[model samples]
Target: MSGSDTVFNVKPGGALHGAVRVAGDKSISHRSIMLGSLAEGVTEVNGFLEGDDCLATMNAFRAMGVSIDHHGEGWVRIEGAGLKGLQKPAGPLDLGNSGTSMRLLAGICAGQDFDVTLTGDASLSKRPMRRVTEPLEAMGARIETAAGGTPPLKIAGGHLLKGMDYVLPMASAQVKSCVLLAGMYAEGETCTTEPAPTRDHTERMLNGFGYSVQRQGARACLQGGGKLTAARIDVPADISSAAFFMVGASIAPNSDITLENVGINPTRDGVITILREMGANIEVLNPREVCGEPVADIRVRAARLQGIAIPEAQVPLAIDEFPAIFVAAACAEGTTVLTGAEELRVKESDRIQVMADGLQALGISAEPTPDGIRIQGGQPGAGTVQSHGDHRISMSFAMAALRARGEIIIEDCANVNTSFPGFVELAASCGLNISQN
Candidate 1:
């Protein structure tokens, strides 16, 4: 994970069977410590993501004078500094490659009195912050940015942010969470509406912390100035993380595997829906509530998958999984066309072009559209694939490479550490012959 490139060697496999638990829900893990550090008392979080990105967020908050302690294992105790208590850190908060941290922190900073400036790693710095900053300004916060509306945001001393019923041009969890966090300190009812739904981890976590947040239609209404209370949360397994397994089982012939503790939040279940629509045998087993979010064990069995047109409505739900979805598309019975998903261009990579390019290199006919991709499905061809320095793209092709008619090699695999840190291990455990070469 510390070099110029990492490589993945994926071997074909037989049916896969086992129960594996992934890292904690990354979205909820970020919000827990954040909301906890600002609540009235200490919040206990179990199953927190130990990933680099969430750790960056934790470190940034600690620099602001909040108290957070790691317990035995997979547990964290965050002491609330209370609302309006985050002192300015001595330096620019370095959010290394985490757009989640950069965007969510932008909103949190909007209501603070301290003079704070938010910065990020090379990749994070390149992501557009204007989406979050634009809304913050309408709330009466002063924010300055660089050209292209990217990061290294200069946030002046906070102001009395007024709550507004802002409408989002795009459906993004980061943007929605940013506005909701800012609403915590606003003076009135703060609300946000999106053209389409995104992840609602913040709203669920806030309710778990005893804050009353109501959702109306596409909008979430938050009563400003309501203090968050101490609570215990067991972060569910990340659905995004589980997506790798779903695609792995769905494509590997005769495979059946179960991923435990997966978060089944309605907004994040797009991957499951799309795969089931393609005729994969996946079952949601022992579904229950942990804290306030839904959790389940998902069992996936490999089958002959048939392609179907992916609706634009489902785009917002499965936005992050298209790289892997494209893998499913490659093996589906017919042409799979995806539309109304232009956001894929701005992720860790231009997923549309990167996937289409990589698939083409493997002899699959894939074309990147302005909004999405169209693919001709069949047996995967043989060739080397590039990850484009994007974690999901790297892993998606690694899985796609498994079904290749020839040995598959993936370049630039170190990016997998950003989200799913031990991704190669997870793949190997699932019976794929994967190695770091």
Candidate 2:
């Protein structure tokens, strides 16, 4: 978890079995710390993601004088700092590889009384911050990004922000959440109209904290100067993390596995929908709600998948799960065509290109387009692939080894801890012949 030189060696031929629970939802874990620190009372969180990214969020709040106690194993207590209570940090906030932390915090810092600078590691530094910064600037916050609209985002504080009705240039929950977070300190109502529906965790969590976010069709609107009241949050297992094994069980022979307590928030369930459309045998068992998010146990069995044209509408819904979905496409019986996912080009890596490159290295026919990719179903042949330090890419290829004809070695997998910690150990326990070095 501490080095960027980690490698994963996965041997071919294994069937995933038994029940497994992934780490808490990364997106929700992030928002919990952000909103909790801004609330008026103490907040207790269960199933919090202890990944490096969420820890970065916690450390950021702590640097601003918030007290967060980690009870270990997915439990956290946040002593709220209240609105207008956050202090100026002693130095720049280093977010490591967490774009979520950097982007969302940019909006929060924009409305602060003290100047704040948000920074990140190399990968995150290259990601586009203008998507959030431009919108926040429109709301009357002074934000300066690096050349070409990247990070270390310098937000000049003490500006009285005035909210505006904004239209998102793209479908992004982070951008939407950023503007909305900044709106809390604005002088008027802030509204975001998305071209397509993205995750609504921010809206849902705001309601949980006794803040009102109005939803009408594709638009979410909230007035400024609202108070956030502390509440208990139970973060569900991240479906994105569960996706690797879900694809593994679907592709590997005699594999049957149940993923427990996973978040099935409708906005984020496109991965399941896409997989099911590809002929995956997945069942939603014990569907329920937890902490304003849908939760369920997912049981997936080995099935002969036949790839189809991925529905464009589901693109924004499962944006982060496409890496694993690509692996499923490789093992399926026909070609998988994905489009309306240009967002993939700007993630931890150019996921569209990275996944295509990895799949091709393993002897799969993959062609990357500007927005998406077309993958031909086939058995993967062994080869070393580069993960570009992308956690999802690393895990996706590891699962690909299940159907590989030879050993698969993945390079630069140290970033796996950014999202899914203990992934190798958990995958190994579930019968994936994977080892970390």
Candidate 3:
């Protein structure tokens, strides 16, 4: 579907069944392209997500003189340019809707010998960039942003950066990874202490590439002047993408589903933890290791869900899955309250407000707060919900259709390709009557 022409029509009363494996982890996919581009040898990646977001990351690296061969069927070969080997791109790096690409690449561009400008789509351009620019500037990398600290970032590279100890005001893996990537070019050691843990894909991928990233509790440290050797990476299924089905199966009656080869890294397993705490029946089976990260198969069965006060400590862990979790909350038995997640306001869309509006339109009682939202569980009637160009919001509403009273129309769903390319097909295969038009 054309970007402007994409929409989703979902009918009520469907259940997911059987087993499925979601696309490659979006977080790991972006890092694979990035770390692979900077390594010394050829990096072979299996199960790469062919989504627009990760593709944006790949294309950006390609513009920077990285040779990437896309073999059909999720196989990619990236010819690594050793650290400090990236050439200046001829024009601005357009990162599309991927905040991950824009922020993470800012760090990689910080130590280069050339000046670069990074821009994104309308939605991404509106998101904050100062979170990254501030830390990069403190390390002596000259940086500029649009008014209100938005994107269209102008980064002046080749400056000597000095390492510093930084404490993150919020638990954000993107910001943490940004500084860590810049730390690679700084003099001496750089350390970051987060208020809470975030995803560790960057750190693990660094170790897989033969670079040492030391972690102790909430703090992680990395040294400058290191080399990365290209290594084989088998990207696992993304838990965030699987979260829709996880919630779908949990809320829909007589539904049972298994998600295979999902990355269950401790830092990224917050959704599973939160769901279990809310009385979801999810099982972790056949645990193993893949490319330095933990992997397992998850089986979820339908159960009566109860709303509980979500612990703030789990906010950062399950941040990306909250949209889908909110759908589960609407189908739950009580009130679900979440807090300490004001970061949602600055995502691709204002997730808290957008979700609350959508839920209210569906006839559910969802109250949006400055930091979080409170939802009262009840049957959702048919309604049209706008995605606001956020992929998670689009998919989350689609999951809600399973329990909706009538057909639900989801607008601006084109962005679903940003993370999960075959979302409609996958959902339909598992018994969801969802179609893209």
Candidates' C-alpha lDDT: 0.86, 0.94, 0.93
Q: Rank candidates, lDDT, best first.
A: 2, 3, 1
Worst 10 residues of 2 by lDDT: 1-10
- For model 1, the superposed segments whose C-alpha errors exceed 4 Å read 1-3
Number of the top-ranking candidate, with lDDT as the measure: 2
Q: Name the weakest run of 10 consecutive residues (lDDT summed) in model 1.
A: 1-10
Query: Between which residue pairs do clashes occur in model 2?
Result: none
When superposed on Cα atoms, how far off is each prediction in RMSD?
1.4, 0.9, 0.9
lDDT of 2 by residue, 338-396 (tens): 98899999999999999999999999999999989999999999999999999999999
On lDDT, the stronger of 1 and 2 is: 2
Mark the regions of model 3 whose C-alpha exceeds 4 Å error after superposition: 1-3
lDDT, candidate 1, at 87: 93
Clashes of each: 0, 0, 0
- Clash-forming residue pairs, model 1: none
At residue 409, give the lDDT of candidate 3: 90
Error of 2 at 139 (Å): 1.1
Task: Give candidate 1's error at residue 24 in angstroms.
Answer: 1.5
